[model samples]
Target: MGQAGATFPQSLWDPSFLFLTSGTSEGGSREGLWGHVDQLNRTLAQHTEDIAHLRDDLLDCRAQLAEQLEKNLLFPQISTSLLSVALMYMEAQRKPDPEKAIAGGTGD
Candidate 1:
């Protein structure tokens, strides 16, 4: 085989493609293959864990947003109800003026 690729510095893409081929064994040892496999497994496990955490965070954020949206949607109605209740309470607490009641008496 020609050493055209080996003559220069190894590019960034070489290692990923090289290790999969039969002729490019890492020092002609099976240990290298197992090492790569183990690394890949660890990476996969870490990614799975990260994805789970992200999903949980997303769900929590969604719940919070839903709650805030509910509050926002009902704010006007709640305020109006409270104002009406306050007005009703004020109206109930007001007493009739004594002078007006006496002056408006029937003259028959």
Candidate 2:
């Protein structure tokens, strides 16, 4: 075929390129592949451990938030009950007892 019509130049098919395509390059050796695989395994193991720790931390945080939410929900009711009791006591004290007032006693 004419050079002008060739898809690629013949120089591009060098021996090093052939070796790489044939899985015979330095990085494609058995030992190199095994080393790469080992590194990948180590990284995956570390990531798994980190993910587990994060999951546990998330669970703890959710539980703490739930407890705080429960406490927050109860506080208003508790405060309202206490206020009602205080107001009732104050109302009772504000009105004088006629008998006690006539007996020269401070009725409030």
Candidate 3:
């Protein structure tokens, strides 16, 4: 029974062979459905491969960035050391008192 007490036919409720054949034919050849499925599978495989490659590339970039950061952090110390050596060389050229400069340089 449907809405408002309307009696529905028993055949409408039954699973008949005619209903199955008509439904399949209306959607065209089954081969087309199989082709679509194959295309979907190929696309999924390509995307999976792309994702794997991206993961590897991302990991490589992260390692390179870490190495770069380590080098960058060491740069300031290197620069300061170089500057100190240069200053010492300049002071030596000026013949400034070594003891005074080592302790505290005279205000000139």
> What TM-scores do the predictions have?
0.53, 0.57, 0.51
Best by lDDT: 2
Worst 10 residues of 2 by lDDT: 18-27
Residues 1-108 of candidate 3 have per-residue lDDT tens digits of: 557865333563454423433437764555775687699999999999999999999999999999999999999999999999999888767856678877897623
- Record all residue pairs in model 3 with backbone atoms less than 3 Å apart, i.e. clashing: none
Specify the highest-TM-score model's number: 2
Q: What's the CA error at residue 77 for candidate 1, in Å? A: 1.4
lDDT of 1 at 85: 100
* lDDT tens digits by residue: candidate 1, 30-95: 566678879999999999999999999999999999999999989989999999999889877877
Global lDDT of model 1 = 0.75
Which candidate model has the greater TM-score, 1 or 2? 2
| Candidate 2 ranges with C-alpha deviation above 4 Å | 1-27, 96-108
lDDT of 2 by residue, 1-108 (tens): 476765432563766544544556552665665677699999999999999999999999999999999999999999999999999899886978899999998785
TM-score of 2: 0.57
Q: Choose 1 or 2, whichever is better by lDDT.
A: 2
